[model samples]
Target: MNKFNMTAIAVAVGLIFSAGMMAQTMSKDDYQAAEATIADKYKADKANCDSQSGKQQDICIAAAKSNKNVAKAELEARHEPSAKHDYDVVVAKAEADYAVASATCQNKSGNDQDVCMKEAKAVETRIKADAEAELKVLNANKTAGKEYTETGMKEKAEMTEARQEAATDKLEANYAVAKEKCDALKDDEKDSCQDAAKMKYGK
Candidate 1:
């Protein structure tokens, strides 16, 4: 791939994985339609390559196949969201790129061809490594999010318990004051006052 195309693919891969976390499964009809569309498109693309010859034909065929494979992987990832599917998309992209690059390398001769093939392999390895790293980072973020939510819940429960204790303490203090006041009242009135305080404080 050229610099511009590689950059575009990188950006796309990032967005795809980001969205993959929340992607819902596609409807059966939609999935089937997409599959049919991909098949038709691949056939048309391959037919276009038939006019070419030698290395040109190889390159054209490689490009057609790569595009098809990548599209199919992307479709699967969208239809069934999972870490495996997302990783598969990345793997498909790497393989597709390597296929194109290898085809291109065949146009060269001698040491030049060897060097080209090696370079293509290196690029494929790098892309695969990058994909693996991205997957690891995504998983780490997911784990961190879950831990944060659990911590928040625990803190909220503690706060609620604290509030209840504070309310109980206030009621007990008020009841003590009410009972002291009742002590100054005479016999029957004092008993009635204490009863009222007890009921009011839920003692």
Candidate 2:
């Protein structure tokens, strides 16, 4: 199978790890137990990866590593329960995602690999920007000691801009993927594919 198939498997594994990490708020006593659970889960995940061979093995290992980081970040967020810690968890997941995508893209060749890398970076940039914007609003509110119901104009503006940026990132990423697919087609068909993508994304 292609590396893309392996990447799909990796995504599934990561998602399973994410599901395993969710829990209620943690006490000091609960911290050790959570850490142990994360470690055990990572071990099991890595074992699964170890069973695979070649590029599949690499992709599976990347997923395991990403999940481990995500699980640790989640545990920290649960233990500390602050905006900063929460943002850290988000960043961990984002970075972990990019790691897997980078690994998968590296396994491919030519335009597919190139576009996949670009799309991965675009996705990571969008997610990090969203996380940062959220942090800014959160820190701003904390400084003002204001409730969420009383958000200021600046916060609203930040959110609006963030939304627009995210939208653009998604559109551009989708466009890149779509256009790359068109490269495999003939002249008229390729033109149609490109035209269709632009029409759909208004690019």
lDDT of each: 0.74, 0.71
- Write candidate 2's Cα lDDT for 10-48 as tens digits: 344324333433545777778998898889999999998
Winner by lDDT: 1
Per-residue lDDT for 72 in model 1? 96
Alpha-carbon deviation at 151 in model 1, angstroms: 16
Residues 122-154 of candidate 1: C-alpha lDDT, one tens digit per residue: 555555555665565566555545455875556
TM-score of 1: 0.64
Number of backbone-clashing residue pairs for each candidate, in the order shown: 0, 0
